[model samples]
Target: MLERLQAALDNNDAQGFSRELGNIAKLRSMAQLAKDTGLGRESLYKALSGEGNPSFGTILKVIHALGLKLNVQLPERTV
Candidate 1:
């Protein structure tokens, strides 16, 4: 599931990423996630539906709720 999400991201597929995210969210307990993220379950669904543009903060909350870490490794710049 996570791999699928990463693949979507690697491909720069926003809608696919959102769909994958929605799938992952469905696998977990939405009530728990809502409580953890302090977001409504319905709202989570809408945001992760690949239609709505969710805020960065909301994405962060969802990622955190899923117990995943996002690491950033920028490529070295060529002078």
Candidate 2:
């Protein structure tokens, strides 16, 4: 799931990111996740539905709430 999310971010795929987030949300209730992330349930849903553009802070909150860490990797150079 983390790999999928990372790939989505790397590819700038909004729908893919939302899909991956939805998958993770399925593991826990959206309401619970919202509470954990200190975000409103409706707002969270909207943001993760691939329709709304969520703020970076919101994304960070969600990632941390899900017990996930964000890391940076350099792109491979082609010979």
Candidate 3:
């Protein structure tokens, strides 16, 4: 699921990506995401808006808040 979400985000498919993130955030109140992420509600709103730019840490917290984990992977090499 996370992989699919990441693919959507990487592709800049706003609708799909936003839907995924929104579902996760929906688990908690916007205020809760704000408090837990240490970002203001307004900031959180912007960061998750699909057009907003946020630090990697902020993105991580939002993912964590949504019970998701980010895994780092090396890119495949061309032969």
Candidate 4:
């Protein structure tokens, strides 16, 4: 799952990543996810629906709610 998300990120496919997250969240129950993330259920649905452009904070919250973390890495090339 992480790999798939990473692939979407690497490919610059924001919608794909959001859609995948939405699918996972739905599987875990949107109500539960909303409670866990402290976000409104409808907002979560809109953000992760692959149509809405969610904020970064929202993305982080959803990722954490899904028991995932977004790791940062330096580019391999050195300046």
**lDDT of candidates 1 onward, in order:** 0.87, 0.82, 0.72, 0.89
lDDT of 1 by residue, 1-79 (tens): 8899999988888778877888888889888889999999999988899897888798889889999877777878999
Residue by residue across 27-59, what tens digits does model 2's lDDT show? 778888999988999888888877878887887
Q: Write the per-residue lDDT of candidate 4 for residues 1-79, one digit (tens) a residue.
A: 6677788899999998998888888988999999998999999999999898988899999888888888889989978
Q: Among all windows of ten consecutive residues in candidate 4, which has the lowest summed lDDT?
A: 1-10
TM-score of 4: 0.86
What order do you get sorting by lDDT, best first? 4, 1, 2, 3
lDDT of 2 at 3: 87
Instruction: List the candidates' TM-scores in order.
Output: 0.86, 0.79, 0.65, 0.86
**Deviation from native of the Cα of residue 61 in model 4, angstroms:** 0.5
| Residue 28 Cα positional deviation in candidate 3, in Å, after optimal superposition | 3.0
Judging by lDDT, tell me the better candidate of 1 and 4. Answer: 4
Cα lDDT of model 3 overall?
A: 0.72
Per-candidate clashes, comma-separated: 0, 0, 0, 0
lDDT: which is higher, 2 or 3? 2
